[model samples]
Target: MEFIARATAVVGGAVALVRRIGAPGHQAMGPSPQIPEAKAQGIMTLKMPVARGWKEGHVPTCAPGLAVNAFATGLDHPRWIEVLPNGDVLVAESKEQAGPPRTLMDHAAQATMRRAKAIGDSANRVTLLRDANGDGVAEVQEVFVQDQNQPFGMALIGDRFYLGNTDGIVVFDYTPGATSLTGAGRKLVSFKPHGHWTRSLIASPDGTKVYAGVGSLSNIGDMGMEAEEGRAAIWELDVASEKARIFASGLRNAVGMAWEPATGTLWTVVNERDGLGDETPPDYLTSVRDGGFYGWPYSYWGGTVDDRVKQDPALVARAITPDYALGGHTASLGLCWMPAGTLPGFGEGMVIGQHGSWNRSKLSGYKLIFVPFANGAPAGPPRDILTGFLSPDEKLAYGRPVGVVVGADGRSLLMADDVGDVIWRVTGA
Candidate 1:
């Protein structure tokens, strides 16, 4: 079947995608009407029973010592952050432009209609927030750099910083004592942004390789790139040489990447293909292996093929399923392998940020969670460490965790909340 046909087949379910982007405010998280196409096929329902036992600590609040900044001061949607040796956090803010359709001056009517009604023109930049004198609170912030082409992800390596966004990647010269990012950055490589709107990034532990993720342009079909040259993939590049290659493919949205110190494996938290309704293909967490594929368009978690996309025979043979599905439509982000350790009330674990759900009627996943690790890797179920980002009744969600970094001290953690524009710190007592 043609991709256009597959796209048409799921047009009814596409409303959920719109709702995901457009639905705003707190009261929207309730038992809601299902999208007919999604519900009829049993795809978009919020079926998971809430785990009542996942109790948060008595301090039902975002931790103190939040250093709000020039980035945090005006950042409407911050997505990722990194810390330099001096203790200042570098923040990435993702802002979107949503409104009436921008006209396309094309003779082809079909092409004109293809342009999005809500077009996004964005910028990505970094800022420095410091808590002077070892105080729990941040005292100063400086605009390190600005004017990035819609940046989203970051990692600090040596004297330079790398950032990934919708358009491509850039390398910044950074030092602990630098007041601001001066001069220009080196352009690593470029990719056309697909519609899922996330570019998660992580550099290897040894500082030799860099991995930048490119999510699918659509939910499940190709934009003529996959069958030709696979686009839904984690791109690995040599930091020094800037030689880039497709590290892994078939993932819908591998929006989170981290290096596990215990095993040295690259782990990714993904936002799988949607439109099966609410629950067909579960979003996932998996160790990303080089040159491997996590099936997308054709197959989903545990070989549940997306019928609409599977209709395209071209995608069937290449479909490779996922490892562990982390539940449906959780919108998983910010994968970080916990530095091996034990802390009060918290088990040894990996940290994953669920940016929160939009497709379902009742909202799910608006917090930071730690997935327990046993010997050295992800071993147990996820435990909620930070709650109340969303309201008690689950109506109003005030924040979304977009990034997590284990501090140099090893026991403390820093969280970047894109929605609320603050860097929350979680300290172990």
Candidate 2:
């Protein structure tokens, strides 16, 4: 029975690919995206690319007037990045935990990840890179912390260091300019582990609190809504007492977050649920408000009900429409604030590292982008900051950009390329 179901899904996917019938990618972008009705296939549209590492002396193509280089190379699946006050770069090297393939769709998903070089035993460590002389490339590289459970985000407030492991947030005592963490550290707060297990962390500008993004347990509550009790929401933690609460609810997968400077508003890039059609509901970038709800399983894009789930009209009525759409399945992760003069011609904006798509017929994202901001709102269309991560044929991928941050020098941009196993630095030409 499982084999028959799998075979049927494969044939259906092939036929859909041949027809090439889907919404145009550009039509589902920016502030006002053209969202169509739901077109849920029995199985997902899988277009996984084979991972091919960068060739010697070759790198992702930067936008004109910008140059890029491998700041540090040969790391093990680097996924997220953080910079310390002393100009030291910390990278979290990790991978998702593999579970048993229970359903035909799960089997197909596993195969897709295997081909994409995304499934493996995690490195489970955080590494430090330093460019001592202010050159673009790092002269010192060393493992800063190890034996972690898929660590993704790192923050340092005063002398206390916070690490966002998959199951919980761990706090460590640290000394400035130290090379590595020798202490075992204790868990500050616990979170349910496994499903959508990237716990991304950011500290308040005042260094008094921390925010963490936790994703849903399944697509649209397939695992039962009760199982998703504390998932799919951003959490706020008080540094002194370690008390935590949900900051915002109904974000399916809010991986990357940043604070808007002008308004001090918290903003995030959320990856919406899959299995819907190519453009049923676009992934979005939005300002996260306290006690607010953005639709997930019950609805999306402001009360557009997903009929697949049990209807809840009351929750749907309160669903907040996102500020801007980033196109469907773009997997817009790794967000950071970019000040006006940080990268030459670019104005104040947000830098987004899109990890690209696996659940769409045609690929989306696969590059770094910048959304210009004016008066604390998105002012213009997204601009490509780096391109060519995917080959022209779109079958081979050189890299997937994750966790982006302004370099310690405040002029260059640093991005983590997990598939390529390198950290790329971008600066004015």
Best by TM-score: 2
Name every residue pair that clashes in candidate 2.
none
Clashing residue pairs for model 1: 43-276, 43-277, 43-278, 44-277, 44-278, 45-278, 295-320
Name the runs in model 1 displaced over 4 angstroms.
1-74, 98-123, 222-230, 310-321, 392-394
Per-residue lDDT over 103-161 for candidate 2, one digit per residue giving the tens place of the 0 to 100 score: 87677677667667787799999999999988799999998999999999899999999
Please give the distance, in angstroms, between residue 251's alpha carbon in candidate 2 and its true position after superposition: 0.3
Compare the candidates by lDDT and give the number of the best one: 2
Q: Write one digit per residue (lDDT tens) for candidate 1, span 120-193.
A: 34546677777666644566777778887677787778888887867788888876678678779888888766
lDDT of each: 0.62, 0.89
Model 1 scores worst on lDDT over the 10 consecutive residues at: 104-113
Q: Which stretches of candidate 2 lie over 4 Å from their true place?
A: 1-16
